[model samples]
Target: MLRLLTRFIGLLLLAGGFIALIVDGTRSIAGGRLLVTTLNKGASEFFPALYQGLQNGVSEKSAFLWDPVFTTLLLLPISVAFGGLGALLIVLSHKQETTPRYWRR
Candidate 1:
């Protein structure tokens, strides 16, 4: 029963981690492209002060926080770790089957 429980939890976590990874990866890629395109298009439309600030790279630091790729990358390690831990638990939960000496002919 304990083994089953462990296996179940392991499977759940493994699946969840994989799903998160895939979703985050896709979102990150799409978001990065969109951000670049938008920034380029909006560059000329910005007010003089804002345009100068952008040219001076003032928003670079804060922009990183808003980047989906960076956010997703941050979550990647956690997802990978959870998946690895779940796999380990699943392996440990496996039982070694054996037969009694009396049953061996």
Candidate 2:
């Protein structure tokens, strides 16, 4: 029963992570132009020092890192982690499909 519950929760996490990824992806795509603008605005609001440095002539490449593209990319790992952890739990709860070679001998 514990195993069954674990597997159910794992499946839910996996589904939820994937769903979140899809939604985030769509949002990033839809707000393409607003991506950098929003990130800059957010940074100004939350991390003024970082925003100040960015405004002080940071490299274009470096500036882009603070944009929505990077933000979306950053979320990939979080979603993947959720799915990976859920898969791990599901695998841990399941019985081995094959007997160990040492046991057979």
TM-scores, in order shown? Answer: 0.49, 0.49
- Looking at candidate 2, what is the lDDT of residue 53? 73
For candidate 2, lDDT tens digit of each residue in 34-84? 222233344567899876776565446575755655556434444565678
Per-residue accuracy of model 1 over 33-85 as CA lDDT, tens digit each: 42221233333455667666754563476765545643343343545756887
Residue-level lDDT for 33 in candidate 2? 38
Q: Which pairs of residues collide in candidate 2?
A: none
lDDT of 1: 0.64
> Against the true structure, whose lDDT is highest?
2
Off by over 4 Å in 1: 33-76, 97-105
- Candidate 1 scores a C-alpha RMSD against the true structure in Å of 13.4
